[model samples]
Target: MLHLRVVCPQGRTADVTGVLRDEPGVAHLVVHPGVAVHPAGDLVEADVARECADDLLGRLADLGIDHDGGITLEQLDTVLSDRADAAEEAAPGDGADAVVWDELINRTGEESRLSLSFLTFLTIACLLAAIGAVTDSPVTVVGAMVLGPEFGPMAAVAVGLVLRRRDLVTRGAVALAAGFPLAMLVTALATLLFDAAGWLTADALDALDQVDFIYEVGPFSLLVALLAGAAGMLSLTSAKSSVLVGVFISVTTVPAAAFASVAAIEGRWSEAGQSVLQLGVNVVGVVVAAALVLLLARSRSRRRGADRALSDG
Candidate 1:
């Protein structure tokens, strides 16, 4: 639920009130006449009955209503009692689970289209990772991982699945599939240039040859991917954006790809293949984990509605 506040010019209060009265998801309408400050006529407060705050905001914007006013959930609950029945009636049932599949596909498509910023960040990340691999410095490798913007698409894919948005899934998948190859090609070119400068060392080549971790993919990596995916999604969905910085470091997608590029440049074919596999594993793991998390969040929301209905009954 969302609380919406509207401030309108004095004469226009009635017009705004009339508009909101007909909106489907709005409840707890209150009109405070003669509430004025400089350039303001009246203040209106209300609660939205739906969970989709973005959709609600769009509707309000279409009505030409200034939504900068603040409303509190507690105040809304105290003012409105009639919406309880309506909210209960709108609750979902078990069959709503199918929406998850649809959302996954939709999100994938949305993530596929790369923005200019995304491309720029990815290129820099791949370059950093390649450098890190050549230097055999874990710190630089982690820095490259943190710099990569791949999680945006991964998180979008998860959100699409949870929201049952087929378009998002397609976009996300396209972005992920395209992004890696682009990063790989650029990194490969950079690696070759670096190697030509005689900067590639034997130790770096040996580091790439150590392929034990790639084949050892098991529950630990999966768990880390899952946690990182969940954190990434939460950061995207919530106001707490700083947390996503850590999430970028927790996943191995960029680092592994960098390793692969470095290995290829040094003529370590077997190790390059292993690094490729590691990158693939991380990508798949994060996507799958994010999908699951979104599914769970949606299910929990549905269950809350059901429980509220039972209590009201």
Candidate 2:
């Protein structure tokens, strides 16, 4: 359920109220006249079902209530009508709300910075990829994928584009562009150290060359990234965020990045190019898919407002 608080001009209260009263999925209407000081108008409060929120908002906009005031929807998790029902049933509005855009971007930025804090995770991802290449272990490759943190910025870029948020786009691009090169440089240094310690040899480098998956870039990989990106955005928008953890592992962005780093470390230019191409494919696919998702979400919101207006009429 969604609770909406609407403020409108004094003369517009009746029209807004009438609209809200007729809208489907709305109940428990309360009108407080001449309560708003900012717009100096009346306030209409009501509880609406989740499915009807968008439509209700649209109707309200059509009624011109949004011009005089604002509408806010608070999700209610539980509903207890009878006062006595409260003893057995916990009241609604108890659960923490979904994370919004500000929180998501802030968290992503923090994670990106943390990932760059030490070269350890980057190095480990690259080492794992290298080992995966030598041993041809899909499991090890997946582990490298999970360990890499390249998706945050890629997602950020998509979010930025859809929202027209230049700052987010800039930050996201910087993080992604810097992240791969930084990882590659660190992995290269690590390779040198390992060689000096006799932990890496020409045979290991040759084994990396034999790995075939890195060079295989096609439409299939792009499709996977697109799907993964959509899933990722859905996970972000949903109340259940635990699903995103799995999404983080499902996308090959990080693994490809790790591969690129490993290839650079081994001085395999052709493999490095393949890895870079893979990274590009995944990034582009996710960004395009995510942008589409956000666009659709915004369009739904607009349609919901239109429905609200029709209800008012």
Candidate 3:
């Protein structure tokens, strides 16, 4: 379920309330007239079933309330009312399966920012992965994979493509374009420094039998990337953090980037090129798979909403 807060102007109050009243997926609808001073309107609040939230928000958007007033949507962690249960039951689909576009876009938009923290996390994750590559440490490689923040921007790219929002697409693309190269460059420099300081060695790189998959673009790499990308997007929409972590661990993006930088620094040109190719393949697979997943989910949800409307009519 989600909690909705709306500021409705005096002139459009009746129309807004009428829409709210007609929505069976709304629960505990409350309207306090002349309560909003800043927007100079009434304050209306309600709990909307998650499955119906996108549709309800779309209807409200069409009413021009967003221009004259405002709408706030929030996740409800706990809703004890029987009305909440009834609202979910009456809704077209399950809340757990709902794709709240507004929430998703907002989340991915913020996460995709090329902020300092984003760069720092990616850099640290790659450094960790580089170390793992030299030591043949699978655990360290997994940690780097989990620590990498690239998934959010990748998801933003897919979301932008599906929605045809150029701003989102541009933001995500810029982040990826600037972020990976910068991180890899830094890691490559660091690799040389560490090698000079006797921290990393050529013998260790040669003895790497466990984590060689980092540089190898095997037959299953793209397939796993496709599966992980779809699962990652679903986890994002469904609020499944545990599943999302698994998705993060399942992809070889961070490992490939880290190994590419390390291998290049050590003059392993062929391995470096292959690692770069693996990175590109994984990224392309994820973006394409996730975009397809979002497209299907959006179509199915809209179709169900339309079917429910026909039944109601």
Q: Per-residue CA lDDT of candidate 3, range 76-159, in tens?
A: 889999998998898877888899898899999999999999999999999999988888889999999999999988999999
lDDT of 3: 0.90
Residue-level lDDT tens digits of model 2 in 247-267: 766676656666666666667
Best by TM-score: 3
Q: List where candidate 3 sits over 4 angstroms from the true fold.
A: none
Which lDDT value does model 1 have at 50?
Answer: 37
lDDT against the true structure, per candidate, is: 0.66, 0.68, 0.90
- Model 1, 190-258: lDDT tens digits are 887876887875455655433334323567777888788777665544434588889888888887777
Models sorted by lDDT, best on top: 3, 2, 1
Which model is ahead, 1 or 2, in terms of lDDT? Answer: 2
Q: What are the root-mean-square deviations of the candidates from the true structure over C-alphas?
A: 8.0, 7.2, 1.3
Deviating ranges (above 4 Å) for candidate 2: 1-124, 205-211
Badly placed stretches (over 4 Å) of model 1 are: 1-113, 201-203, 207-219, 310-313
TM-score of model 1 relative to the true fold? 0.67
